[model samples]
Target: MRRPATTRAITRATTLAAAALVAAGSLSACAVGGSDDGPLVVVSTNILGDVVENLVGDEVEVMTLMKPDADPHSFEISAQEAARLRSADLVVSNGLGLEEGLQQHLDAAADEDVPTFVAGDVIEVLEYAEGDAAGTPDSHFWTDPARVLDVVDALAPVLADLDGVDAGVVEEQAADYRAEVEQVDAEMTESFASIPAERRALVTNHHVFGYLADRFDFEVVGAVIPGGTTLAAPSASDLADLVGAVEETGVPTIFAESSSPDRLVQALASEADVHVDVVELFTESLTAPDGGAPDYLTMMRVNTERITDGLSA
Candidate 1:
């Protein structure tokens, strides 16, 4: 027997619809300091949210739109939250078309003169070289810790200048945090250097590791999905070709994206008839507080360790 939906469900639907309408409405309705909830910084992804929180400390409130273990490409915010974007003290996003659904909202905030920092803008961006997505900018720049340093360089000053926040604390934290990033970068270099370059080939759920490959001398042998984004579907021939690549490359593992399902990669491994292992990595999103990857540094270190371990096997 079917159970009828409750009033709470109907109220939730109405709230989302209202938010959409507000998001689509005039920016003129946006108020000064948009959130009375307190000194606020709104970030599009949990990863960047963690970065910003580290810089700001407890001086301000950080509103992260995307939850842990969620895909950033297709995630959307409430219209009310979209409206709040225009009013926040600062907005940070990993811009290169990574936030597919939320780009318009980011743009709206920028259009309203909200000082928005895009991670892609500060870092040297990589473009897709082949396929239909050829020439499209890859937004997965955080894969390289060095490029993320560029992001920190560009944002540190802007964050220091925000009103109601202690500039000294921001600078101090940024420097300390940058040092931590540098240390991690050195460790990753030393560790991955141990792996034979030929053995350092990779296959992922999607085209996500271009920067990481470029930085660490790893080869992006192939992907289960064809494009830079996860929403892409693979044709049978695509899977067949990837299977052949796997066989030829002798790559040992196919990394299942943490934010996405591994069923496809699992099936791909079976279909390819290869004895490859499928491993999960926190690729795009962070995890809950108690999960394996709770922040950017931990996420990168965990991935580095896993990648090294997998390929070295």
Candidate 2:
């Protein structure tokens, strides 16, 4: 549920007008303080920020525009925050239209000729639904470690191109990271393969696991949201149809996303008389530092364990 374009425009206009007024008076220093210098890396979402930070280590300063547990569809940056986007030397985004709210800022940054990289662009996409409608690619490629290996592959060259970064060092590190990703992918494949082929079906809140299912050869029976993004609401008929599908498919678990509430899925489970395990998979954003699914590697591992356990029974 993103704010309307009109609302965003008004907000941006009002903030800029206020900044101008303050600059004319006494608050100029406060207004200018947000433009401090560093490596000037701008990441679209927090999950990608964690990945980039792990790749770059302490070599560069990174800032994530989206906060922890923030919905990617609706998260908005302030005017001062938008200034950071403009001043950044490198901008990394999830792409695949994950940052619906910050698209204008991204476009403006592109207009200014800031170097931008889309992590999802490197990975092969899984389209759950078709057409120019909103939320098509599902944007949950990180769920599959294989797909994220593609991201790591793209990221190495991009980091090498940045100023003050050693291309050779980044290349070696990227190769090491890609090996790790491949290992994880192998582990996931083995783990998920344990679930009997008959039970290798998934029921989720939305179309979050298309990539994972495709990679591991699981059937995506149905989703409560009935769309690629969580922004779409399921109508009563849609819910009824989904419940029927769940009953027909006999999927033992209905997985839920870490960032989205699961009340609807719970209710659907109760009404359908099926055992729905609300497995918290990292669908949109990564968890906080102390949370279970804190980073990309851990997130995929935890999700794999959960999915395997839930389906094996």
Candidate 3:
């Protein structure tokens, strides 16, 4: 059985924080690119890295730059990893301004003429409905399985065209993965539909669930932070407004991203007039294999169940 989100979240956050410190010292010594035999696909975030790995399997070497449980909005790459980007056969990123810290490296690779596949480019982008980032494109499209299918459809062709990858194998894997995404979408639709309309309000740590809310018919009541990126801080008045929304909506649960600490969400819950529970969801990055949200599919499933339970209660 999987551990409780609170238990797992605290453990993973503490472990990852220590790991980051250790990694800072050892990253330079660690290898960035894989062995020199096959075409290498360097991915910006671990979530998309898992997707590329699933699609290409052993056909090509896949290098994911972001560490597990790291914030994509602020995670930075080492000099070695940045150098490897220019030499990669294909560079994949969850663009739409998500990778704030790594954008320069991505741009550098693009300027060098490295082929790039941005997941945001192929999907119908959604803008933040109401926040400091209200008019900007949201990079959290992976929250919805349907949009993820769009990414897979566009990415499969790119991977197949790579020199060392087998077109037939990549095509077959893409089809199978597409089916999995479709199944998950159907399941999510059914699960979310069961939620009472009035109870389907969501409060989160940041504006990361617009895509999921748009896809599932949930109302985004408010967020602790006012924008799309976690790097931005929420003002006292901003928190006051969110507390009012929580009271007005009577939203019982507020979600915190697994990649970030839940202290802010906890504080928000405490300040709300209505009693609220804080739940953790895997929004930004994939976790290590032993972590609860190890891959994209599992991450979606885990979040679906958690959201359903949180709102229903």
Ranking by TM-score: 3, 1, 2
lDDT per residue for candidate 2 within 1-313, as digits (tens), equals: 8999999999999999999888776565654544343366899998888878777765567888989888887799999989989989899998887788889999999999999998877888877652233445668788778778788878877877777776787677777777877888988988987999989998877777788888899988878887776787888987888789888878888888877898888878887867666666677887788888777777778888989998998
Best by lDDT: 3
Q: lDDT per prediction?
A: 0.88, 0.81, 0.91
Clash pairs for candidate 3:
none
Worst 10 residues of 1 by lDDT: 26-35
Flag regions of model 3 displaced more than 4 Å: 1-34
List the candidates' TM-scores in order.
0.86, 0.84, 0.88
- Model 1's alpha-carbon lDDT is 0.88
Please state the error at residue 4 of candidate 3 in Å.
72
Q: Write the per-residue lDDT of candidate 1 for residues 1-313, one digit (tens) a residue.
A: 6445787788889999999888766453454345453467899999999988888887778899999988999888998898888898899999898999888899989999988888888889999755557799988998999998898888988888878778899999999999999999998999899888788998988889999999888888888888888888888888888899898988888899899899889988887655899999998999998989999999999999999998988
Worst 10 residues of 2 by lDDT: 29-38
Model 1 residue 168 CA deviation in Å: 0.8
Q: Which 10 successive residues of model 3 have the least lDDT summed?
A: 28-37
Taking the tens digit of each residue's C-alpha lDDT, what string does model 3 give over 1-313?
9999999999999999999989875764454433575798999999999999889978988999999999999999899999999999999999999999999999999999999999999999999887789999999999999999999999999999999778999999999888988999998998888888899998888999899989888888888888999998899999999989999989889999998888999999999888899999999988998999999999999999999999999
C-alpha-based local distance difference test score of model 2: 0.81
Ranking by lDDT: 3, 1, 2
